[model samples]
Target: MNAKFMITPVVFSMLLLASCGGSYSSNSSDSTNSYGSNNNSYGSTANDSNKNDMRSDSKPMILTQKDVLETVKSKINSDIVVMLPKDIPLSSDSHFLSAKTTDAPDAYQVIFYETKNPISVNSDDLKEASKATAIATVSGKSYMTEQEAADATGHMDNVNTGMNGVDLGSNITGYTDAGAGSTFLNWAEGRWSMSVRNTTSADQQDSIDLAKKVVAMLEKETLPAPHQVGGMKLEAMPNKADGNIISWQNDKTDYTVSNFKDPLDGVKITTSFTK
Candidate 1:
């Protein structure tokens, strides 16, 4: 069977940090506005009645990390595992926009923003109305096998001339690619191929050091094993003014944690999920 695993692209340059305090039209698609470089804008949509109800409330509705996870769980099949951060390091000002399944039935996503306004169940004007300090997402989808999933993460465009070895301490020797203001440290654990990147830094040592720290952490709190092979990618780009992103796969599902400021926090969020 043809493997259907694809790595979600990380578009850091186009991220918008705005408040979600404006009104949204109810006619927008359910998955139209979100925080990413996937050509989709960031905003919320709500019916008129729900909008009025939200406007009357003095305090905006706050959805905890657990709340969003539950919401996503309800939308997808119970057999498909979903993972998210146990606790986000953001302030209390963050508001959950929506949590629902994507175009695919087996896939699900949840979005939240660091804003002070309440997003209605149907609020549509989130793209132009809110000022958010940061945007984050937790998304998951199913795949066939770990090896096929791992192979899909290979990015031909990122190939560079500078290369070195990265020893992850488990007899698993990874490699580093440095060039064009970008550095990447890549390795594999069991059936999982892992990589950590720094787009703004070409320092090979920085990528290697961060990779070591992340690998040490994974040794203690492990991720769910994949059936065959899997893939994980972490990125740190402080100059983008947007959040960092971390993605991985396990069993038959591919998971992503995005819009975080720190790379270490991304790893913490990924390991927080349980079977």
Candidate 2:
């Protein structure tokens, strides 16, 4: 069977991240973003001399069920799980923006989340908003050696600079920025990159508390696999009306991505094939 998995926007974002670097968006309009580039190991150098074309005739990459399965399998080992506290009175619109897994010998998975809590925002109440809004992203990576993992983390220095460093023991390390009202922290549980972040005017301590809660919740929760419809195990995503999201279809299945309370479980797949 000649099966081609249509590229959804989520998958496209993952591909872009791999080809380029990661990108982040926020609800804060006045927020200033910065990322550091290294010239040593993580940095790149320019080669002035050019040679003959070494390009080969390669077929366009097509995603398949096997590829989806392997990607989901890599996510099963991720040490991160996003679950907001019941007492926080969060918005029902909390959602997982995108998730992707790639098997590059060093298999890895990345998931992004956007969450918000109901709060009273007054123009004079706080700096940006009266409530807490954040984007929590987790990346589970497998490296060929411990040295590779160590080298990859070096870029984090640029991420944590100017923020107040928070020491949550040896396993968890992070920083809190009061000016930006953001808390960023990540821990390496083996090869997995687990992170918890809070971007709000809430206290730095609040961010730490949230991080602890996430770590505790993740200890008991396992990432859910993609949904299976008919005989094909397709990647399940939420529904969004904004037309900003991407949609895809295979010969047997079609996926319309959207925003929901949860990425994996929030949006229900209701198709003629699903009974």
Candidate 3:
């Protein structure tokens, strides 16, 4: 799986403007409502506690190596064991670290990066001083439907990067934004979504390369056979019409999962086996 950090467009522009040393107008409601008073750009959940965690002046969260390990182990619930590249460095600094899980449909992530000492988001020189860091990120999610993935990515224009050796003009949608010495890529195949961002030009290929590697890995892994998972009893079967299948039925309902090679582009597909 691929992982990328996302910031709102207004937030991105805000950073650019702030970097230019301009102050916001006190009387401007349009600016004050979104960016000034609430700062929704950083996200409403990113309350003062998160800000204090990123800034060095406040009390450190004091995470240990074991704490990081336990946090990762506790959240993982998938059978697929995706691996990242070898060279990405690891650190425990709160400013450059994050790990969490999202629900409704299950997902988990663990990310770590190393930067210079005394990292501070509020510092004037953050853009220049923290340009280089070793970042490693891993994420896994299971979606009940394609629309769920679409909702998360905001239905952005998906582009074919040809990173996975698919045909030209494949419909696999994605988003890419490059600026401030950084680049980000996000794409999905079926119900699975992946993202990668690189601030250091040196590691720009890391996300792309890892994405392809993951595609290759999942393509070869064994399928989840029909069995009892969570509380449902799934049964593995073959459908000559729809191809191979793993299905579940409980009196009133039925669910099926299957894989197919997307003819438009060869991005390995595991999708609901709908007729």
Candidate 4:
């Protein structure tokens, strides 16, 4: 399966500009918003504090509402594209998920994703897609799996650098184009997943919205896409968790640490890792 981080723009109507006053076009160069009184960086439930379900830690993470807000706040101001929340822990039996907003006052981009075990793939590694997988067809590229989409592009040293939007990859079939911000990664459904959503960016509203969407999915505990490798309908190893069937990165650290308008632009990069 393919993992993807999405940089989707919030669709708003221009006719409502009189009440809202802004042309929300999808551009990467919009002036960022400030953490002012109108700051919607923190989700309404972000400060609830009582819904503590997965934040348990051994180091006693002193996570205060203010601290969480501040961390998210910094990402909002720094023009970073955060895909998940902060300090999310990864696990084998559980999935970690969160989202940060990247919509500057002048922008409205958001990233979304789920957690899974990272698969190891070498140059010769390739797995077929499954029916459960909802392929995304952005531009003209077809991402059969989420990982293919996640690892497509973006320097995830960490940020909202993956596939974007909901039910996005569903219509994508045969093939699609990778956007400048496209990225791919390997992920498992349960066993390999650990603190899935790693939020680190300078954007907020979009981050919050992404987080909400992820949390909403988490509430239902969405499973990974099933597999059907090599013309065979695989049953996901019986009881084992489902995740990216093909995944692996090279040992060559010659990676390009940068962002893009179309994530596919970086495909020219060659990895040092070989099978």
Top lDDT hit: 1
lDDT of 1 by residue, 160-212 (tens): 22356657675656677656877667776665666777765355566677778
Give candidate 2's error at residue 119 in angstroms.
Answer: 32
- Model 2 residue pairs with clashes: 238-258, 239-258, 240-258
lDDT by residue (tens digit), candidate 4, 70-146: 45445553222222122222223343222233444322222211223222111111132221111111011224454
lDDT of 2 by residue, 189-216 (tens): 3223334444554444654664555445
Q: Answer with 2 or 3, whichever has the higher lDDT.
A: 3
Quick one: RMSD of model 2?
31.6
Cα shift from native, residue 100, model 3 (Å): 13
TM-score-sorted candidate list, best first: 1, 2, 3, 4
**lDDT of each candidate versus the true structure:** 0.56, 0.33, 0.37, 0.25
Tens digit per residue, CA lDDT, model 3, 91-209: 34343433333222344443433444433322333334344242333344445554443343222334335344331123444455567875656665443334444564556455455
* Candidate 1 global lDDT: 0.56
What are the clash counts of all predictions, listed in order?
Answer: 23, 3, 4, 66
- Would you list the rank order by lDDT, best first? 1, 3, 2, 4
Q: Pick the candidate with the highest TM-score.
A: 1
| Error in Å for residue 133 of model 2 | 20
